[model samples]
Every structure is written in C-alpha cells, then in structure tokens.
Target: MNNAWTDFLARQGTLPARTAEGATVAVPLTQLGLIRSRGEDSAPFLHNLLSNDINKLAADAAELNSFNTPKGRMLASLLIWREADGHLLALSADILPALLKKLSMYVLRSKVKLSDASAELALAGVAGPRTAELLAAAGLPVPAAPRRHAPAGEGRVIRLGDETFIVALPPDALPAAFEALAAAGAQPAGTDAWMLATIRAGLPLVTAATQEAFVAQMLNYELIGGVSFQKGCYPGQEIVARTQYLGKVKKRMFRVHIDAAEAPAPGADLYAPAFEEQSVGQLVNVAAAPQGGFEALAVLRTSSREAGKVHVGAPDGPALRFLDLPYALP
Candidate 1:
C-alpha cells in the first residue's frame, strides 16, 4: 500500500455511519489486498487450484473463487478479475501474505508468477444511489451489469451491483480519482460502511480468524457462484463434489441482525434451542449497523435456522434477528 494514499485516507475523519441499505459513498478498501498472476500458465495453474472454473473466466468479467484445503475448507476467498497482462485477485489483506507464500509452494514448473500488487494498485469502492453518475463523471467506465469489469484510466472499474462499483486503479491515480467523485456528491465512506454493504449483499468474506472453519458449501459458496460443479479436481474437490451430488449440505450461511451491545467477531459460536449445548452456527462476517446493532453473516444448520431463534456468543446470549439475502437460496 502507498503511504501517500494511506495518509490521505487517515485524514477522512471517523468511520461513516451506514445501514444495510447502504449510502452514496466513496471508500478506500483498505481491508482487501491485491495479487497479480502473469504468465502463460496463470489460468491453468489457478484453474487447478480454485473452486471456480478459471478456464471459463471471461475477459470482461470477474468471479468469486476460493483456495481451499484438502478437506474442502477455504483458506482464502478471492474476487478474480482480468487485466491486459494477466489476472488480478482481491482478497482479505490479513491472509494475503500467507496465501501468497502457500501458493508459491505449488508453482514448481508453472510459468505463472505471483506478486503482491497492493503497493502499485489501490481499490476504491463507489457505492449508493449515485454510484453510476459519480463513476461516469470521474472518467470511469460504468459497467452495465454486476460481475462485469471494464478498463478505465489506470486500472479497472468493476460494477458489483446497481448501486455499487469498485475502481481498482494505480495508487498514484487514486487520490485524484477519489477527489473527483467526492466533489460530485460522493461522501467519504470508510471501510465500515463498505463492509455493511458486503454483508447485506450476502457476500461471504473469509478472513484469517475464520479460515478453514467451514467448508465451501457452509459459506454458501455454491449459492453465490464461488464454486463450479463442472470444474475439474482441486484440493478437496472430492468432498465438495460429494457434498453437492449427495445432497448432504446441511449448513448454509445466512444474513442476520444482532442487537448486542458489543459487536461480534468472526468464528464466534452460535447456539439454537434445538441444538442444546452444541454450537449450531458460527459468525462468518460482521459489521456494525448504522442502527444500534450489527449486520452479519453466519453459517448455521438449516434445521436450526428454521427451528427458532439463534443466539450469538452463547446459548443464552443475545438472539440474532434474521435478515433477507439479496439472492435466493435453494
């Protein structure tokens, strides 16, 4: 990361207040780190390792993919997109260093080369009602649909949703680009708000604390296009495929509202009445809601979710209020 860009964001004051509905804000996504893969073997190398089908990735699009353990547990969840030279992956920053090292261990004779690109590239999230207008005014391409990316100034403009866009550009270009959008009525939203938007969108972000705690299906990877049933064998592919084909996926991630006084952290145990003393769920991602509680994602037994209330932290702790996910689940 660039110290200049980091310094500029440090002066942006406190975290912006936001709700599940989101706001018209421009945010520096400091939580995510970028990784670059360039070489003839980049696609094939990644195709053999990740949950998503890399072979089918389109030039103008991005896909939710994961690096999983041999047991089908996720080590890292990434948003993979294309670039002129090769591919770029955006994942939780806390896990990037270790993930990069682990991936390198597998690059025996592969032509692909991986490097941390966070210093050179920066990610700025433009969200809310004015997202499109602000992008166009900033001289960025406004993608027509979600999951599609378009080349812009020095990086790429990715449209995540109707009200959300992420611009990945050169670190040197971020300050100017951000200023132009803010001048056009985009509030300087901090990572807190950006995180809320992600939780509400039902996008599961696997962080360091929650790594390998659940399988790909438990996080609803399959439901949200993070997994490809048709893709060839990856680490733990057999278990993942068996879970799918045998119809044995019982636990799935769900969105919820927790009215606790303090915010919950990832990997926190959840309980349900029917499950008794057993932990029926675990918090996956959490962000403070603009309201007096937290908006979060949790992986829970489908049976527990339907039985009754699920509480966070303890069996008798604060109850979690369920929320609707942007997409439907089967």
Candidate 2:
C-alpha cells in the first residue's frame, strides 16, 4: 500500500458513506492495477496481441480492450491509454502477475518491455454532479468527454462517463491531490461506490474466476467499443469474426437488480427454470446498490433473459429483475 495515499484516506475518516445532497466523492481504486508496456515495438506488438486496434490509440484517448485465448474465450479485460513513453493498461490486480507473464512470453525478439506500474502510480475515482468543478479547483485538467484524457500534474485525468472521472498520479503526489479535491467539497468514498457506479454504467470486468469463461461478444465487449471487427488478426480474431458474421451469438450481458442480503460473487452461476439443472448465465460483476440490495451485470443466454425466470445461485435462489443498460444491445 502507498503510505501517502493511505494516510490521506485515513485522514478523510470512514468512507463509503452517503454524503449530503450536492456533494461529490473521491473513491480509492485499490482493486485496480496498472501494466506498462514500453519500448519501440509497444504499439504494434500490443496491436497484434489484444482485441482493439492499439495502433490507432492516441495519447489523449483511452479505450476498452480484451485479451483472449485462441479458443476465443476472454482471459482479461483492459482499459488502455497512451503516454509519451509507452502505454498503460489498467486491470484487476488479482490477475496482473499472470497477465504480465503471459504477455511477456509473446514478446520474443520484439522491442517491448512489460512491468507492473502499481507501485509507481495511484488511481482514485471521483463522481457526482460537482466532480468537474472539484477537479478544476484542484488544478486538474478534466477531459471534455467520455474516454478522453487530459494531463494533470505529472499524471492524467480520464473521464469515464457523465460526472465520473479517474485521477491517475504518482503515489507521492496523491496526498496533495486528495487534499485539493477534499477541500473543494469532495467526500471520500470506498471502492465499492465506484464499482457500483461502474455496473450501473454497464461496464464489464473480467475477474480471476471468470477468466476464459466467455468470448468477447458474450460479454458484449464489442457492443461497448472493446472490440474492433476491422482490426487484423489477434489470437481469437478468426473466431470472433466468425461469431459476428455468422450471427451465432447466443449469450449476452445484461444489467439486473437482485434483492439479496449478500452480494453475489463474480462467476457465480445463474439458473433459470427453462435451463433446469444447467446454468443459463454467470455473474460478471456486482456491487451494493445505493437504493438497497445489489446491482449487477450478468451474461445470460438471450432466451433466458427474455423468457425464463432467473435466480442468483440455484434454481430456487433469489430472483433477478432485469434492468435497462445504459446502452442498447446490438
């Protein structure tokens, strides 16, 4: 843990608490980790390995991407951005070591070097109607739109969506940044609040348990700008393209609400009456809803989502009610 960042959080008192009306919040994103890919071959090497067209990535933009097995199953989901020297990939910390090793193996003779950047940087999420104002007061340059990024003091601010921005900076610079944000009326929040907002926005995260469980399309990765059908071959390009053109996609991710006491884990099986003993879906990610209960994103068969009654764990488990995603399914 970063002592500076941790101390700043401690000084802020207990978080994940609701703030008064009109107040904003900054949540620490401890679960996320960063991977830096540098050297001359960074762009093309990554372009040939990941699902998105890294060759087209601009220094001021960020994009969602995925790494898949040859069998076309998604192994990891990534948020990629470019910097002056190299590229940065943000993903779940639990899978970072393995992913780094896996990516290194493909380097061969390429001029690419990959390493974990978690220790060098810290990430925090700020949201609420006043986020832009707070960031401006902190001397940070806020991105003008979603997926766009602007330079901050030796770091960057990425606008994830409406009223939501991610602040990435050196660990040593975090305390001052947090202080500035807090002074500007931003409340401190726990990571769960940020995650809850992510689910509501219909973003998908691939956790350890869910690795290789679905293809990019099954998680609606392409629908949300995570895939590029026009890009040249990657590991699973052939299968991904075939699925898209052949119209064989049977499962899709959906946003839903579950009135349960405990939050369901990612990769938990979801059953429907029509599927009998078989699971018709799997939980992708979930978080406690501000309105009570849980809000989650699950990948389920289209048939099950349309007609069958869905349950959390088993056939008789707590029921899941469908919720509209921020974007329409293709």
Candidate 3:
C-alpha cells in the first residue's frame, strides 16, 4: 500500500491497495446536468418509463437501470436512489444534458418535475475494500454490506467496494468533505480507476453513441439484478420480456482485459473479426488494470465475443483478451 488510503484499503482486503493517484474525484452531479424526479407520481411515473422496476427499489437502496426509447434503444443508463420525497437519478457527467432533454419529453401529464440536480450535489468515488473503512472513519454513513447504499450527510452513497461510493454530496459542503476525506487518507483517483472498477464489477454505463443500442439483456442487466422480468410493464417492457422468453439474446455485455495503456473512449465502436462492415459492439467504460495495461466493459454480439479477436481504437486497434466478469450472465 503506497498511499494511506491504499494502506487502509489493504486492511479491509480490497485488492491492489494502491494503483494510481487521482483515483477519486468529487464532481458536481447537478453541474453534470442530471435530471431530478419529485412529486406524488414520481415513482409510478418513473416505473412506467424505465427498464427496471422502480417500485421494487426500497428506500435508501440504489439500483442500476436504463431509460430506453420505444425501439429498444437505451437512452440513458442511471444509478437511481430513492430519497424521502423523490428519486435522484445519477448519470454519466458527460450525458447529463442530453439525458435531461431525452427524459423530459415523457414528463407530459405526470406530476414529476425533471430538472438537472447535478449542480446541487457532488459526486465522488473510490476503489478498493478500504473504502468502507474510510467512509466509517470519515463519520460518513457506510452502506451496510456490499451492493447497498444510504444517504450520508445529505448525499446519496453507494458501496462499490472495489470502487469507491458514488456519493451525492451537497455542493457547498463538498470542499470540506473532500478535505476531510483526503486528510483521512483517501487518494483522488481519476475516472479511469472508477470506470475500470465498474467494468470489473460488471457495471455497465450508457452514453451517446450507444444510446438505444441495447436492451437490458444485451447489457446483461438481468445478471446484475438491474431488471425484473416478472415486474410489470416499463417502457419497452414487451420487447425486454419477449427477448428473455421467446428471443435468444444474440448480444450481451462482456469484460475484456487488454494490454494497452490508453483507455478507449466510452461508446467507441468495437470491431471483431466476425463483423466486417458493421460494428459488433461498443465500449461502455475502461479503467487501468491493477497489474498493467487496461480493462474495460463492452456490449457485443455474444457470438463474436465467444469467437474472440476483440479490438478497439482502430479498425485494427489493440486486441483485447476476455476476462471473467465478477458476475454470471443469465
């Protein structure tokens, strides 16, 4: 463990104690342009619009799901947290504006108010086991086991032990929180670390180029508990359910280990030996590997993935080797 944070994480058993400095960053969610949902019909309204069962998400619990167009295209991938009065939708900082505009069109008669709250809150993340202890030591409320999240000091926090929590901190309080956490020994890892951690954790994030490119199944949402086929209709539920029962999922998300120092941009087209002209898949996220090179998550045709020869950054970019994902596909 090179950094104090890494040393603390080693104590908690999160692998690869120290990888890089700037591993974490406190970004403003509202400033990132996230949309908010508040009002009496918020849950039901969202329930009807997204891929997952919004009603099933218990208070303080967080879930990963997507908002898809009627044509089975994922418009935005979100990490949602149910607050006391409404729901907080956390999305990629890059896609916040477009996400807001896309989801806003459906707000018609619904009582929900969709506005960007990213500016009002701070978003922070960590990677490694020591993250839990760091949270506890910082006097922040840590999520009770793995895959749990809670409101800590007016922020929505999720426990991604291999990665840090995606905490929604109050804007004005962010500087103080960052100072405190740094003083307590948390290094500021960049998005690279968090993205790689997410890929390793089997977490998929959606972006512009890949929007509406995949259904929940294609993204392996079922495998990660992001979808409930039994849950009643959400937007495109018919297609989502049919794909599971009647249709075989030809495409799905895959984790790959590549020996490249440069991280590919999200939504970058992925070419495979099987696919000649059309792209076989798209990159969801990438991160620096613990040992060396890089690791990333991508959605691709299962057949192509199984056949191997995955490459990115070129028609003949660096070749990628498949890695076992932390989770199993359905």
- Best prediction by TM-score: 1
Error of 3 at 253 (Å): 1.2
The alpha-carbon RMSD values of the candidates against the true structure, listed in the order shown, are: 1.5, 1.7, 6.2
Each candidate's TM vs. the true structure?
A: 0.96, 0.95, 0.85
What does candidate 3's lDDT look like per residue over 1-330, in tens digits? Answer: 023333333343433322654344332222133567998889988888887788878875777778877766777787787878788887766677777787788889988888877656656665565676666666777787555787777776776544457666666565556556666777654455666667778888776656777888888887787777777777777888888889999888888877876767777788887776578888877777767777888888888877888788665888878989887776
290: Cα error in model 1, Å: 2.1
The candidate that achieves the highest lDDT relative to the unseen native structure: 2
How high is the CA lDDT of each candidate model? 0.87, 0.88, 0.71
Error of 1 at 249 (Å): 1.4
Number of backbone clashes in candidate 1: 0
- Considering TM-score, which of the candidate structures 1 and 3 is the better prediction for this target? 1
Give per-residue CA lDDT, model 2, range 188-261, as digits (tens): 87777777778878888898989999999998888889999988999988889899999678999999999998
Candidate 1 residue lDDT tens string, 80-125: 9987767999999999999999999989999999999999888998
Q: Model 3, clash count?
A: 23
Residue range with the least summed lDDT across 10 consecutive positions in model 3? 24-33
Pitting candidate 2 against candidate 3, the one with the higher TM-score is 2
Better of 1 and 2 by lDDT: 2
